[model samples]
Target: MEVATRYARQVAVIGVHSPKFSAERDPANLAAALERHDVAYPVVADPDLTLWNQYAIRAWPTLVAVDARGRVVARHEGEIALPDLLESLRPLRGPDGFVAGDAPEDASGDEPALANTLRYPAGILADAARDLLVIADTGHHRLVVASLDGQIRFTLGDGVPGLVDGTGDRVRFRWPRGMAMLPDGRLAVADTGNHALRLIDLGAHTTETVAGTGEQARHRMSGPGAARETPMASPWAVAWFAGELWVAAAGTHQLLALDLEKGTLRPAAGSGAEGLHDGPLAEAAFAQPSGLAVAGGRLYVAEAESSAIRQVDPATGRVRRLVGRGLFDWGDRDGVGDTVRLQHPLGLAADPDDARPILSIADTYNGRIKRLESETRTVARVFGGGDREQGEMGDEDGVGTAARLRSPAALAVAGDRVFVTDTDNGVVRVGDLATGRMNVLRLEP
Candidate 1:
């Protein structure tokens, strides 16, 4: 996109994620391709056009014009012409909008333009919104929260060493590993240390334990002696889907689906706690299930020892392998003779705006993120692989960050931003989902 077209504002562009596009679609290359020689303003590199499909765009460059009510007023598509671009941008230009090309409604929506900054530099990964970014500073044994502009919103769970109802409130997270958003706008933390699900009420500014009052795992049952029935065995990842909370009970080697509203738990895709199969629940199991992400009524799980990404059909306990050749097989590629396999994969998420429910896998050992199109089970390489240093796709060294991202462990995507829990360096790196540029949401430069 020409910098002039979306100058001083934000806009997202969509396209099919073809090898041809990823190869030639580098941001630096975009300016040259567009004949600007140089350009600014992020051009959301949506290879799958996830946003396009969901937002109902007929073609590329379908600009969704939002109103103050956060509703899309107009949509422009197909190599937007100058006149069409101007027309699509009219509402955001006047005094009513926040920035250039920003819709009138989005102007005052929930996201804050300025990001809050903190002193934690070792941020390994971050998950957040325009208003909030959760940093998983692993080395520090704590999770950090900041505003959209990188402002230090607050660092949470800095105290205690237990997992239970009384371990700690929002202020204390015991080595929290991952973060997720609740339906009510509250924040959920995989208080890893305590082996529990922690909740943070954004409105109340208070923290509480929503699940696993005790630091242990068990099956979910109802009634009478059912108090401790809903247990998670070393639960590592958490996801909100279909109005329920799902946990990867690594300790038990099973996926525990919880009805957060009713406080009920049940064996979801796997019956028993250990095994990998489409057979009955008990026959199916996992080897240290870690990352958990939900989209389009399906759940994705990252099996560490097994080295496979398992897809779970929520309604029926059906399971299938999305990636990897076999259990404990570490290769460079897949199907090409045991090569290109995931090494110690951890975090996982689905591209919301995409039609394929693409699974973004943080191949931890590979230091890269792999986008797996669930529909076809094909994989595309994104930020990561052999060079874990810093930059858009810099997790090449068995660590997630190229430079700013020291070790990305978790994934969170809200609105137009993508966050990673850069645990090693102890800081969360927030970037624009479209441009993939390092976005610091703080008051400081």
Candidate 2:
């Protein structure tokens, strides 16, 4: 993205998106994703993977550089560093060197107005005790605090994409995601795009950078350093467990731990490898673990890439898979143990009142809210997708499966109300567990 912004005139970058899941094949879903990520370049949807076959692409993000004459100049199979990519493109320059063209027009002007205040909200936290609903308004780069009754209480950040820290509207965050309340009542945020963990003092209306160096970590296995000194790769979600902050470092494929009292950061689990391997903490591998929840004295992880749910014992330092088969095994099936399948679930919320270990999952790609019973090892759809065709998602509100959701990214359970971050729809869908109905949360400014 930085490269595209820097050389927008000299280069023409086009994104070719190949669908990985059934829901991703939808044109509306693809457009929402592009807009949520603030994509400025033109992107073509390759629903049938025609471009993948033509380009011989074997990875989700393979970059093929084409010259001015439409000749393939260079190819990168995986994520390439900005400096490395810039160096490789130097060969395309002519003898007189590349000339800068006029600045590109703002593509955002063509986008439709959002239906509500929130735009691509990603993560949510329901504090039933405080009667508060905290939402990670991702695309807007801010945190919204709302009362349980849908009234906006307050907000953090200045609604600008930045990493600056200050008070109230002066503070800034870049696409912040998951959030957890500290023991002292402060809120901790996984400032994803900034690669930092931020602390919000709600009482004082102040925000501070507690962890990360404001730069993406080049090394996946770096840690055991001071909290402010450690460079972190995109920390997607955060959970407070065992008197520490557990971070799903998605970009590095590892779980990180930050001890607030000790002021130190270190790797808690994973081997920095992207796959589905469970065992000892140091040997276990995670594929883009994006969501996290703590319950029953264990930490639950939502692996987006593998479409799997895993549990980690903080005391034993062991990791185990609860559902999903492997990296390539994914769908929308409900059953017991290994028979159950999920399609890129991204958020989890523990049912506080349930004596049995139960979790509410935001099945992002499937556009459904599922309930997972750890004791019985059973998964079932609680909301969205009824008799409708598979992969057909919408924004209609109805009873149970009759309701429709579009790429629900994260959810939070408060009492009997399930607050869902309807990401692609840019709205929060509140579900009634008792009544089996769902409705859009109307935010009052």
The number of clashing residue pairs in each candidate reads: 77, 0
Local accuracy of candidate 2 as per-residue lDDT tens digits, 77-132? 76556667777777687776556555455343234323248888998888989989
Q: Top model by lDDT, which number? A: 2
RMSD of each: 23.5, 2.6
Instruction: State the displacement of the C-alpha of residue 36, model 1, in Å, after optimal TM-score superposition.
Output: 46
Per-candidate TM equals 0.61, 0.94
Q: After superposition, how far is residue 71 of candidate 2 from its true place, in Å?
A: 3.7
Q: Candidate 2, residue 24: CA error in Å?
A: 1.4
lDDT of 1: 0.55
Deviation of model 2 at 184, angstroms: 1.2
Q: Candidate 2 at 189: error in angstroms? A: 0.5
Query: Residue 31 in model 2: shift from native, Å?
Result: 1.1
Q: Distance from true position, residue 345, model 2, in Å?
A: 0.5
